[model samples]
Target chain A: MAETIPLEQVLGTWVAALLTLAIFSFLYRDNPVYKIAEHMFVGVSAGYGVVITWREAVIPDLIQPLLDPAAVDLAGPNYVVLIPGALGMLMFSRFFPRYDWLSRWPIAFVMGYSSGLAIPAAIQMQLLPQLHATLQPVWPAGEVTWWMALSNLLLFVGVLCTLAYFYFSREHKGALGVASRIGIFFLMVAFGAGFGQAVMARVSLLIGRVRFLYDDWWMTLVAPWFGGG
Target chain B: MRLQIPLAITFLIGLFMAVQFFVPHEVFQYSFESLLAWVRIVGAFALVLGIGSLLRTHWDKIRRRRRDWPYSIVTIVSFLAMCVIGIGFGHEPGTVFYWVFENIQVPLDATMFSLLAFFIASAAFRTFRARSTEATLLLVAAVVVMLGRVPSALIVSFGDTAVGHYLHANMPDVSEWIMNFPTVAGKRGIIFGVALGAIATALRVILGIERSHLGGGGGGGQ
Candidate 1:
């Protein structure tokens, strides 16, 4: 005999749907029902983050290493991580005006280190080679079609105009002004193509979610009856 | 002392890292990896701060009964409910957290972003008129690329075999080439220039010449 479905689960499902629809109602206009859902979402997300941080980072990365020093091998048992960890904790000290300055060390370290890393890498990887590549192109290896030749020429032209778009040492005037305008048009076309690609990606994600809800979840509940003794 | 110290650190660290990149030493590589891990940890903490602010802002709105206050309440309730289910109940697939995330979050995010499609179409319709030689070229290129992208273009029967295939192959190839070769190359060039400028800026900071980021007095306080 089939088991009767529980009312609680049914109610939970309905609550979930109501909440989902409430949030979606934002597309029409902002309303109070949406605000409650948004606030609840923020609280829950924070709570989730706190839990994950404790489980994933604090417990595993920081605490575990301290508790069993020999078991942890990554950076060796220097009291260094403890210094930053203490500073991170000191950030809470900002709530008390007297001890707030203690938080500055970690903040400074974070800013200093990030800029130190990002600035250099951005120069080397993104800047230099790209500059060099723009100036040169490898000639066709063996045979060449007119189409290929035309494509290469267009590519070179596009690169030049795009580069011209950002050239602001002097005011864009005469030839420079015309070139920059052309560059912007090319950039817009590129962006339009990218925007299309982004739409396609989001569509696939929606389809995947719908499939999980309708096909996977529904089948799990219904499929057992087909093989009944 | 507050801003000056940080600024000084930025300048010195920036200079050091740039030098380290050119040097092929194991010490530099090790330092970089360890530093990278430290930065990642700090970044995660920043995310927590952002979430706290999001909760506070919404809660205050709900409390005051501000215009559109119900939306804030709804948002908070749904958020908290999901978090409890996600964290407490283990946010595995088919669970409450998963159900809400899959059903609500994914759809809402997608739909909001998808609205851009209609906006783009309307904008294109308004702007894509052929007025000049340059405009005509652009319109021609757009139509050609649009047609070439989909398989349905083959069934449109613009002509017989020859001219249509030429349009199909050539226009798309040109568009693809423009994107892959020129557009990419141009972007890369700009990126490189910015990078060099960054290196210069970082060097200036490290040496204490450029201290604008550290505040008005520069490195004098340090």
Candidate 2:
């Protein structure tokens, strides 16, 4: 026996299915259906962002502080918000040419703050870790084998040559040119692998849409209407 | 006042935020968290400006009778509808707003991005001509990875026993070697270069040597 489905759910599936096809219609050519779908996507996403930001961010960071100052663990009623609050307001100064410079203040803050924050984090997270990993023993503790040594040697050489390729101070001539060519090989391999993984991801996404259309839309809604289980 | 004040603010804020990294005291932690809260507040506030710009763009298109102007009506109306519903009734699961999000927005967003797969395939087809040694290497590696990702069991199920076992034994290992060694080495080299550049750029901003952020004349000062 087939279980009865709710009207709202069935209708929702129709909306989802139509919109999915509308979006995929772009693969054919630019059409009104695609354009409407694209526009609706943008608008709906923006609206969604607003509600989410309000619920998760503005309510806690802005409203809550104002509503109950003591709710904040910080000293002095979380007046710290006033600083960024004012800076944020200055972002609107871009609309007025005469005071466009006001916006620069906030821009500078974000840039400098972000740049500063990113530096140490990048060094700690990316540079140091990669360097450290590269410096590990060519052979693992248990695997005292030639293949392991060879792989480790290759990794170290690959990294150095790749770095040499990017070092623009000296022209790539003689040994440097050879190293740079090898660097290209490593980079191509990396890019190729990344691309292959990306294809798998995209195929999986398509599979998702197909599954939704089949199991959810066809079996539940369309089949029921057609008097098929 | 404009140049000096902005640069000083950047230097101080940047230095303070960076310095917080070394400070381990709970008091400093509280201060850091407070500062992060301020950043989040500013970010949230910035979203309003983003939405405003989006609305203004669509509204202008509609007003000017631009190409596909009628579609702007769809955007504006959908935006307004969602906004009114979401803001007024709230986004709880049972609400109309939530239903719209689940049914309409979710599918649209997912399907829209999913279209990139076709574009990637087309791009790959065009680029993988094997005209050069580098291109050949890239194409070969891509093929290996693609084939390797398909499980041997699946391949066997499709009735290719000899190739299936061969791939099952070696393909995955080969793919892993490509990723774990060559790819990682290339990526790490890039990361090192980027990290150094970032640190250098940050220092320049702090020292007031890089003022492009302030706009007009690269923010080289008034």
Candidate that would win on TM-score: 2
Question: Which candidate comes out best when scored by DockQ?
Answer: 2
lDDT of each: 0.60, 0.83
Tens-digit lDDT string for candidate 1 (A164-217): 888889799999898887787666556545544444454444455445444433
- Angstrom error at residue A49, model 1: 4.9
Candidate 2: regions farther than 4 A off: A1-3, A70-77, A227-229, B151-161, B216-221
In order, the first chain's TM-score in every candidate is 0.73, 0.89
User: Residue B135 deviation, candidate 2, in Å?
Assistant: 0.7
